[model samples]
Target: MNLAHAAPAAVDEGMTCTVADGWWSLDPERPSQPEPVKVVKLKSLTTGEPGVWVQPARGKLTDQQMHIALRRLSDCH
Candidate 1:
């Protein structure tokens, strides 16, 4: 899935997943610790799919960051 086209604004609007790509994640948010901005992969409540909910070690992601995170998560499958 090429996330280059993924819009940050769209993410902000709560469209977490792209079913066509079989992946989805939450927007990056500040954590309690001084760490990279984190995004949590969410499971499809209806499908019961397991999510790759690991916190990445990077700060404030650009569109590239989202792409990288998605790629890493995809590799785990």
Candidate 2:
């Protein structure tokens, strides 16, 4: 699946998700903290014209982190 550019969904509500071990951690108390990866999916809220929305997420993830996550997800397919 080409996630780089996907057909935008509608402008509805968004959501959040976490990817375990997505980021590096050092705190022993929170060894599994990894990082909080937010996943947003836009849904059309209006009618007519297929809603062209943007679903983006940002957390403790950097460009490299995001690339790695996307690569990992792609590898699953």
Candidate 3:
């Protein structure tokens, strides 16, 4: 399994496991450190236009991961 780079915890900027016990580990400085609140940028599926997306007030996420998260959020309602 490929290990993705780990970002700092959004809440406390503490260390987290991106891929626990996986093949690789992320360099502490490589990933973005999240703030207390995070702003996400997304594209509209239908319009194919850029849109503003706000995350759940925290967490560092890549584009693909963010997309999946948004989909999961949409699914809940």
TM-score of 1: 0.21
Query: What are the lDDT scores of the predictions, listed in order?
Result: 0.32, 0.33, 0.29
- Model 3 misplaced regions, further than 4 Å: 1-37, 58-77
* Residue range 1-77, candidate 2, lDDT tens digits: 84343322322323333344543544556755534433333333344322222222343333322222222221110
Ranked candidates (lDDT, high to low):
2, 1, 3
**What is the per-residue lDDT of model 3 for residues 1-77, given as tens digits with 9 covering 90 to 100?**
95333322231112221222211113365443322223344444454433224333323333222221222122111
- TM-score list, all predictions: 0.21, 0.26, 0.18
Which candidate leads the pack in lDDT? 2
Candidate 1, residue 7: the lDDT equals: 24
Model 2 misplaced regions, further than 4 Å: 1-13, 26-34, 40-65, 68-77
Of candidates 3 and 2, the better by lDDT? 2
